[model samples]
Every structure is written in C-alpha cells, then in structure tokens.
Target: MKYLVMVQGTQADYEGMRGKPSPGSPAWSEAELAAMYAYMGAISNDLSETGELVDAQGLAEPARTRLVTAGEDGKPVITDGPYSETKELMAGYWVLECESLERVTEIAARVTRCPGPEGITDYPVVIRPILDGAGDI
Candidate 1:
C-alpha cells in the first residue's frame, strides 16, 4: 500500500525554523535546523535504497499559498494567502510504498522522533492510504 505521511506545522513554526519565532513558537537554532534536515534526509535515502520511497517534498511557506474557492456567481475566487499565522498546514510529506499500515505507522513514528529543541516540537504526523485505481475508488 502507498501512503501519504504528512508533517504539519503553522506559519509560526516556519518562522521559528528560520530563527524568527512568533508568540507561541520557539526559535530553532541553525544547528538544530541542520540536524533535522540531516535526519529527514537519512530516512529518505534509506527508503530510496529499499525502493519504498515514491516521492517526498517540502512545501513553501503559507504566505506564498493561493486559496481558491467558488465565487457567488460561479466564478473562481482567488485569495492571496498568509492565512492565519497559527493555522495548521502541511509542511511536508513523504509518499512511501509499504507492506501494511503497521509498517507505515512505524516509519511515521520515527519521523516524529527527528531532533529539535528540548520542548515545543510536538505536532501531528498525519498518514493516509492513497487510493490508486478505479477499484479503490
């Protein structure tokens, strides 16, 4: 089964990673950020070697996002982003082909264990199975 493992964060979290913390989020030092990147990179490399990694990517900040919705007259309504600073958004994801939910869950748990500051790095790691075919639909 293929699964999407999402790492969630808020705009404040992004700011903190860049060494600019908002009210609730703490700043991440340069070394701390590098460690996180290294840890995640190692996981990706391992999965690539094992042929379990389908894709992995980190999204840009929410400020650069474009929000689209249907207008009242059926036209497309586009809103420039920078939504709520504290709103939770998908920061990155890993698409992995694993044998079972248990396997994916284990991997996700490891991802959550990536190094960070001593406190205030506890966010959710979302996982969902990808429906790939007509039968799955």
Candidate 2:
C-alpha cells in the first residue's frame, strides 16, 4: 500500500519561518545546518536499505505559493498565497510504499525522531494511507 506522510504546522509557525536567517548565516552557523541534513540523510538511507522509501522532499517557503480559485462566473481567479486562513499549513510530505499501515506508522515514528529547524525538534508528521478509485466514494 502507498502512504503519504503530510508535514503540517501552524500559521504562526509558518510565518515565523519566513525571513528568519538561513541556517548557514553567520548568526546561524553551517555546522548546525550540516547536522540537520546529516540526520535526515541517515534516515533516508536507512529507509532505502529497508526498501520502503518511495520519495521524499522538503518544500520551498510557503510565501511563494500561488492560489487559484473559481470565480462566480466560473473563470479562474489567481492570487498570492499561503492559500488558506486555517492555522495549519502543509510543510512537506513523503510517499512510501509499505507492507501495512503498521509499517507506515513505524516509519513515521522513526522520522519523528529526526531533527528539525533551529535545534527545536518537531514531529508533526502525519501518516495516511492512499485511497484507490475502486473504494467507495
């Protein structure tokens, strides 16, 4: 079965992420950045070895996002976006093909242990199984 692990955070968290110094900035330091990358890489490697990892990627900042909607007249309307008023915004995600929901949960648990930005750990990753078209709507 295929699962998608969605990473979500609050609007406050997302806003706070904007214009914050890059990890490599003199105030931030490269060593800290390197460590985070190393930890993520290790997890990726381990997943690959276990043959469960399908794909994963970090996303660009949310401010660059564009929102599209259908107008009353049914024309497309475009606007700048973080897209929604909700507190939660999806940060990134991973697609995994695993043997069972239990296995997917296990992988999510492991990923939750990985380091996050600013040395403050974050484990808001959410795992859900992909639904096929054959299932009831």
lDDT of 1: 0.89
Estimate, for each residue in 22-122, the C-alpha lDDT of model 1 and write its tens digit. Answer: 66678999999999999999999999998999999999988888989999999999988788654788999999999999999999999989898765558
Q: How far out, in Å, is residue 77 in model 2?
A: 0.9
Superposed on all Cα atoms, the candidates' RMSDs to the truth, in angstroms, are: 1.6, 4.3
- Candidate 1 residues lying further than 4 Å off, grouped into runs, are none
When summed lDDT is taken over every stretch of 10 residues in candidate 1, the lowest stretch is 115-124
Q: What's the CA error at residue 75 for candidate 2, in Å?
A: 0.7
TM-score of each: 0.92, 0.75
Error of 1 at 27 (Å): 0.9
Report the C-alpha lDDT of model 2 over 39-130, residue by residue, as the tens digit.
Answer: 77787788788887889887665667778899999999998856567555676777888898998888778767765455442646798778
Evaluated with TM-score, which candidate comes out highest? Answer: 1
Candidate 2, after superposition: displacement of residue 46 in Å? 1.8
